[model samples]
Each structure stands twice: as C-alpha cells, then as structure tokens.
Target: MDRYEGFREFVHGRQQALMRSAYLLTGDASQAEDLLQTVLMRTARHWHRLAGDGNPEAYVRRALINEHVSWRRRLRRRPETPTAHPPDRGRDRGDESLHRLALQEALMRLTPRQRAVLVLRYYEDRSVEETAALLGCSAGTVKSQTSHALGRLRVLAPELADLLNAVDPQEVPR
Candidate 1:
C-alpha cells in the first residue's frame, strides 16, 4: 500500500485514544475537540515526512502535549475575563457522580503540567519514558511530576487514595 493509505489507517486507528487523552488534558469537551482537530491537521500536513517514522503515534502524542502546553501558556498571558452567566447550581446526580466531580475539581487544582503528567501516566497508562517523550522532558521529570501530583491528590482527597488502594484484585481476577 501507499504511504498515504498507511497514514490514513494509522490516524483512524488512533483517533479515539488521542481524543480521550485530549479530553483528560483539557477537561472541556469543546476544547478537547478543537485540540484534537488542530493536532490532526498538523499531523496530516507532515504525513509525508512522518510516514516513514516507526513511532507515528508517539509523534502525534507529543504534538498534542506541546499544543496543550502552548495553549495553556497563552491562556495564562491573557487577563482574566468575567463570566456572563453565574456558576451552575445543578443538583448532584449521586454518590458516584459526586465523587467524580470532586476528583475533577481536585484535578483542576493541579498545575496544567502536573495534570498532564498524571493523566498521561495513570489514565493513559503510559510509561515514564513515553510520557517524557510526549512532554519533551526527561524521564526523571515525569517521575517527579507523577510523585508530586499523586502526593497533592492524596492531600486533596485522602478518601480517594484509600478507595483506590482498597481494591481487591483476587476478587475480580481476569
């Protein structure tokens, strides 16, 4: 098959996983969608150059991380804007949703880079080396960020750490 066809297949196969990672990074569906679209567009533009690379997924993931970091930096440079509408006061769904909401809030409390490291390491199940490559940092940085992020999470929500550690593997062995 041609390089174009191969690149097409590669992108189609990895799109969903990329979107999930983007969602976890941004925490906003619309922003994630836009982020993924931008990444895909940039990837497609360089497909000819990247088609020969064995690790196209890694390249794409790195692009996503760089884009997210750059966007966050730009956002920080802007002045804080007032919201047109008041904060939502919707009723809680249930215990699970409430727990999830608390987790999301805690995630927001982390720095963007810390959140990215945690999501890539734990949520995406990436190794320190992989996350380091994606973030354009060293493996040591990934390890340190993961440790610090988890430490912060533990402080913010000790109950979550307890619940996570309390899972019994033998009860549901695959």
Candidate 2:
C-alpha cells in the first residue's frame, strides 16, 4: 500500500463513481470522458498531497467540481463554431430507459450553478455547508439555490414530485 499500488486500487474502486459524477456535471458523454481523464491525471499527480488529507474522495470530488466550474467559465468565454459532422456515438450511456434518465434530462435543463448545487446536495449526498465549500459559496446561497432548484425540478419533471415527498424537509437545513 506504500507504492503506486494503493493509488491503483483507489482508481479501480472509484472510477465508476468518478465517471458518473463527471457525466452528471457535464451532461455530455464526450465532456465527461475528457473530464474524468483530466481529473485522474491530476489526482495521480497530486495523490500524495491529497492522500494525507484523510478525505481524498471529497478532495477528488471537489477537484471534479472545480474542473467543471472552470470548464463552464472557459466555455462562456470561448466562441462556439458549428461542426460539419456530429459527435461520435456509442458510449457507456448507462440504462437509458431507467426513470433516472428523466431526472438527468431535467437537471440538464437547469443553470450550471443550480445543477451543480442540486447534484452535490442530492445526488452526491453532500451537506449544504460542504456543497457551499466545494462550490465556493455561502451556506445561505446553497439553501436558496437548492430550494429554487427543487422548485424548478418539480415543475420540469412533475413525476419526481413523489420522490421529493419522501425527502424530509428537516434533512435539508433551512
């Protein structure tokens, strides 16, 4: 466990999770693949620095978010030119028929910041404070954004309202 072997094991165990989160953040297969690739490369390079943090998974997740935010910022600045051909198809799209896909699509319709907050708070099961820390925002902002996101989600995907009923209001700090 002292050598690169430990890093290899960590990657093997968490790659799926990393990829899923990346996909959720990006809402595009190609971007998610690229996101995971860059994240892994940076994680490997800074493994020693992060391993000592005792919460490397959180560190890596924060890294993913930072990268996503950075990408969003860059995308905002860059001009998009139309392509002659469409992107390549056939990738691990997961079970597309699952009800989960509906939720994912609805999420993609949200603003990037709202989507990030929703994913961090709900999908990733992070606390408001934790999400705020990761996204570099205040707890109040997280709560308000979460409320707005949930409201939008309810309107965008009414079927998911049942799932919202199952979540105790107290669980998400007001």
Per-residue lDDT of model 2, residues 119-157, tens digit only: 888788888899998888899999888888877888898
lDDT of 1 by residue, 1-174 (tens): 454657778878998999998988887778999999999888887887788777888888878878998998898899678999977868578988777777787887888899998888778877778889888889888877877777787788775876445433332121
Candidate 1 global TM-score: 0.83
Cα miss at 75, model 1 (Å)?
0.9
lDDT of each: 0.80, 0.82
Candidate 2 lDDT score at position 158: 82
Q: In order, how many clashes per candidate?
A: 0, 0
Model 2 residue 77 distance off true place after TM-score fit, in angstroms? 2.4
Q: Which stretches of candidate 1 lie over 4 Å from their true place?
A: 1-4, 87-92, 163-174
Highest-TM-score candidate: 1
- TM-scores, in order shown? 0.83, 0.77
